[model samples]
Target: MTHSLDPAALDQLFLQARTFNKFTAEPVGDDLLRQLYDLYKWGPTSMNTQPGRVVFVRTEEGKQKLKPALMPNNVDKTMAAPVVAIVALDTAFYEHMPTQFPANPAARDLFASNAGLSTDTATRNSSLQGAYLIMAARALGLAAGPMSGFNPTMVNEAFFPDGRWKANFLINLGWGDPSGNRPRGPRLAFEDGVVLA
Candidate 1:
């Protein structure tokens, strides 16, 4: 059996982590970005269908392309962030299922034949992978601000012109500026959110 994480570890990963709206001038290097993916990729997905694909927007030109897609409130902070990760889902992720889930070699055929099933699986698994990215970033001492206020169509047209991948959400990554944070909001208690069956 595995032991629970220590309090400090817990705090780093969840207890004290905040969705930062602003970041410091410090840069999040490419090396750190690679490491972040290396850690987050280990997270499980349904049938190991890791549908999440990330595009790190770090260049000025990239930010410019992303600007119009963002909501007005998200523009300034996102532009100022060291890196903005475009978390996306591959529409045809099942193509890789043969290798990823070799034991179920027929999984690819199953997904390919059912568009609705494939779409549902891609969206759900990619969203879970996005959460894993957040936790991994926090564990690595970086702050993440995941946002859903953007125009997904705009983002897809701008970044994923190939049409194989579609945007799910965006996450701004950097060293957080605590002064920019709002007061911590309330969370649903276990009793309020959970049900025993």
Candidate 2:
């Protein structure tokens, strides 16, 4: 058997998965969430140090727990989504560099010695991974709504009591209906946003 796909399908996928503000009543099961994670976790990372940790808040209790962590504006939309994911970073990501970056133990030492530096790197890299997750969901024919409009302190308190993780952002994933989304916002032109130095 031969594999086949239409190149135009990718374009359609991208166009279809706008920032979905509204979702249907359909639920996003754990299996599909795992598939999404599997696809996005393959994205590039510095020294292959995969620091991003995802927690899917799917149950009513989970969503209720998340409410206190969300900003007032985010609570409604978050509660309505089929699945809400808490994207976070593990501060001890460098501890695993022995396996993730076996050739460069020095890189691991750099982060392991400095607590502040470790947190910074983990947060930055995990944010990149979160972006990869959104794109991956789109590629998988799912819609995503990523938001920074949440109380990081509250989220950390509710989710990572031991202080092993830091909140990066929240992503709501599901089948977004057009009725729930607003008109597409304007973007900067290439010349206006790019620097060709």
Considering every candidate listed, which one attains the maximal lDDT? 1
Distance from true location, Cα of 147 in model 2, Å: 0.7
Error of 2 at 2 (Å): 18
Candidate 1 C-alpha RMSD relative to the actual structure? 0.8
Clashes in model 1: which pairs?
Answer: none
Model 2, span 1-197: residue lDDT tens: 39654666657556445798888988887899989988999998888888999999898998998998788888899999999989999988998898888888698898888988787778878999999999888887778899999999999998899999888999999987778788888888999999999
Q: List ranges where model 2 is wrong by over 4 Å.
A: 1-7, 13-16
Show where candidate 1 strays beyond 4 Å: none
Residues 75-124, candidate 1: write the lDDT tens digits. 99999999999999999999999999999979999999999999999999
Candidate-wise lDDT, in order: 0.96, 0.87
